[model samples]
Every structure is written in structure tokens, then in C-alpha cells.
Target: MRDHGIGHIVGTILDAPENASVVKELKEHAREAGFKAGYNECLSHVNPFYKSKFTDERSGFHGVDTKALYAAAVDTYNNLSISAIDDIEEFLEAENYVDRLRLLYDYPEEEETASGSKEDAGTSGTKED
Candidate 1:
């Protein structure tokens, strides 16, 4: 899990300005370490913006359910990062294959769904109409 989180930090650093040499070096290091480095060019162009009030509201819920909430939040972030990494790897592999085929194509990606069971539905293990 720490490695996954570090991957996200490394990815962000790689996208930062004045880090081209560091990014190149990291790519080589990742290759040696048997880690696949993914490029996220869009992250470099877009700045993430969030409502401060909304963030505070969410933070206020911190100790509401303490352990359960912390577990859920960590699980969610780890899952999201893993999914993003998987999507990037798939895109890169597809791009390489398409380039070899000399065919023009575009990859459309979408968010992955959570692995929830019917029992996970709120209230009694039954669907509500």
C-alpha cells in the first residue's frame, strides 16, 4: 500500500516542471526495480481545485466513525490509485500495438466500478425498490 501511494507521489513529481531529468532517472530506476512507470501528461496541465468549505465539512466527519471511516477512506484511495495505474498501463500497451499496426485509433477510458456485493447494500441484505 505504501508503494502504491509512493507511485502516486512519484507520478506527481514526474509531472512537475524542472523535473525532466529526475523523471528520466526515475523511469530508469523503476525499470530496474521492476516497476512500470506511467506518464500522466494531463495531470501536469490541470490544477486540482476543491471547495475549501466542502473539504472542511468532510474533515469535520473525521472522528464520527473513527476506525471504520479511516479504513474506508484508505481503501478507497488505494483502490482508485490501483485502477488508475491499470488504466494507464492498458492505454500504453494498446498505443504501442496500434502504432505497430499503423492504424489510427483513440482509447476512451472510464471509471471502474467498486466491487460491492448485494449484502453490502444498506439495510437488510435485500434490494430496495
Candidate 2:
């Protein structure tokens, strides 16, 4: 189970300080759905691919296994609260789901920043030369 970006993606979601509550929610949902993908050597990529905190041993994994992990991640993201993500339709429509996850990971911060800028600008928000 080599690091085929799944470890990075999952780690990004689960390891973020801002996502502590979100991780709890995800774990609950995963439990309800019988998803053990986050743990167990049979499921988690990190368990098999990562040998240490700073090392990644590439043993390589099957396409089917990779697809299953990706699907689990995609489904988890899709099930996130609306408050966590304003709109997930665009992400669902993307052909490249892996890249979509990367985008989704950054979407919330981008959205918050954009909305904050709008509020700061107020009405007649045109930029002056």
C-alpha cells in the first residue's frame, strides 16, 4: 500500500486542528456505515504505506483497493454538513475525483476568505484606482 495521495488527502482532513469536530463527525458516520477505512492494516493506507512519521515505503497497492479508498473518502466528503461546505455539487460533477478532493480540502477556507472580503468591502464594493 504505497502512498498514492490517499494518505496525504486523508491526513489533510483528519489532522487539521480546525477539523477536530469534523473528524469526530466523520468517524461517527463511518462507524454507522461500517467503514473501517481509517484503521486496520486491511483498510488504511497509512498503516501499510507509511513506515514512520517521516518515511513512506512504497509497496504499491491494487487499483481496486485504491478505488475503494478513494470512494470511501469521496463519500465521506459528500456526507459532510452543509455548513462545512456550502456547495458540493461542483465537486461531484468533477471527472477527476482525486483532484476534486484536493479542491474540496481548500474550498472552505477560500469561501470564508471570499465572503469575508465581500463583507469588508460592503456595498459599492468597486475597487478604486
Candidate 3:
């Protein structure tokens, strides 16, 4: 776990924050997915014969150990990106699974309003019943 990895981890967490129990869950999953490859590639370049990846085959880790990785990733994410995560979460909901297609048709707004003007957002008067 290093200070530098948090930004990438946080980006993964924010991508699907709803599924994540905590920021760490997201980080661990992301790291397990491809970060390990990238991490190992860099490490190998530094010491091609000696350095190993973050996970070792002797440990029998076919994939990320979610429980263990969660601890490390969360600790790193919290320490480095708690404030950034907080702000990001504030701007968007963790899980936003709206029925977009249904809503798009059900509540079809004027073209101008849909294009998003703040003034129009207040006066989208299609529902004037």
C-alpha cells in the first residue's frame, strides 16, 4: 500500500460506489482486476529477475482476497482520499439506478429543458395540469 495508488483506487470506487461496502471494497476489486498487472509490470521493469507482484502465487491467490485487500485498500484510500471521496459522493449518489429509458419517455421534457438550462429546469412547464 502506497500513498500514490489512492487516486486510481478512488476512481474505481466512485465508478460503482453502491456495490462497495466501503471505499476499500472498490479499491481492492479494482486492484485485483488489473492494478495488480500494472503494478507487477512496473515492479518487474525495475527488477525483472528479483521483484515479484503484489500477490504471490505461493499464497494461492488466484484473485484478490477481498477481505485482506479491503483492509489495505481502504486504509490507503481513507488516508489519502477521504476528503476527495467525500466531495465526490456529495455530488453524486452512490447508487443511481434510475429506469432511465422509462423516465425519459414518461417524463419527456421540452428540448430546451432537456438540454439543461438552470432557468429552464425551474420552468419546465409541460405538466401544467
Candidate 4:
């Protein structure tokens, strides 16, 4: 399974300032939700592949351009926060403040498939038992 640790998730959240506010608000909401908002930079080492995919650029690499990548990351973070906050609001019965904090804790799946589906394509005439 892919490493979806907090640092990896939060680093994606912090990749863009537009999404940084979401991270900030999520931290605040987490504090109010009785969870500590811990910070860690360890994700840099957890998934070397993810790090290379998002931040590094090498010739012959077909990853998204940096600007587009950053924008996508922000959009992804916003969507997830939206979903999380919706769940939180339902749990807390705080419909009134849902909109305010919704964007904070939500994070939706990214629009583009990570690294595409090529990695999963099966070899012709190959079968798995």
C-alpha cells in the first residue's frame, strides 16, 4: 500500500499558499476537535517516488509541469478538506460553522491518476493465479 502518512498528506497541503490556509484551518479545527495538530517533516523520506513525482524535474520525465502540479495539489487538498469538514460538521452537529471550517479539513482524491495506470497494465498473455 502507498504511504499515506500525515507528513506526506500535510506536505501536499502545504505545497501551495492557497491551500496553506486550509492546513492552518484544519489544524485549528483539529485542536478544537480534541486532536493535537502535530507537525513533521518526515514525509520527505517516506516516499521517495512521491517526492520525485511532485517536486523534482528531470529531463525525459513526463510529470506535470511544476505550476500545474502545484495547482492540482492545492485543488486536491481543498476537495479533501471539504469532505472531512462535512463529516466533522455532521458528527458535531455544527451545520452553521460547516462552511467556514469545511474547506479546512477536507481533502479529496486527486483529479489525475498518480503516475497514470501504466504501472498496472498487464503483460499480454500473462495471467496471475
Model 1 C-alpha lDDT per residue in residues 1-129, reported as the tens digit of each score: 132333554565455443554445445444433321111233233435533312222333322444444455445434443433444456446535323222222222222347543321232312234
The lDDT, on a scale of 0 to 1, for candidate 3 is 0.46
- In order, what is each prediction's RMSD in angstroms? 24.6, 17.8, 14.8, 23.6
lDDT string, candidate 2, 25-125, tens digits: 55655453343333334435454666654222323332225445555755766666542233334554556543465565542322336445522223231
Q: Give the TM-score of candidate 3.
A: 0.23
Give the poorly placed runs of model 2, Cα more than 4 Å off: 21-90, 99-129
Pairs clashing in candidate 3?
Answer: none
Instruction: Give the CA lDDT, 0 to 100, for residue 115 in model 1.
Output: 54
Could you estimate the TM-score for every candidate? 0.24, 0.23, 0.23, 0.23
lDDT of 3 by residue, 21-104 (tens): 565565656666555556556656776556553434433335555456656665665665444445444433423212222132
Q: What TM-score does candidate 1 reach? A: 0.24
Clashing residue pairs for model 1: none
User: Which portions of model 3 show Cα errors greater than 4 Å?
Assistant: 1-24, 42-55, 59-126
Ranking by lDDT: 3, 2, 4, 1
In model 4, what is the error at residue 60, expressed in angstroms? 4.3
Task: Report every candidate's CA lDDT.
Answer: 0.37, 0.45, 0.46, 0.41
lDDT for model 2 = 0.45
Error of 2 at 117 (Å): 44
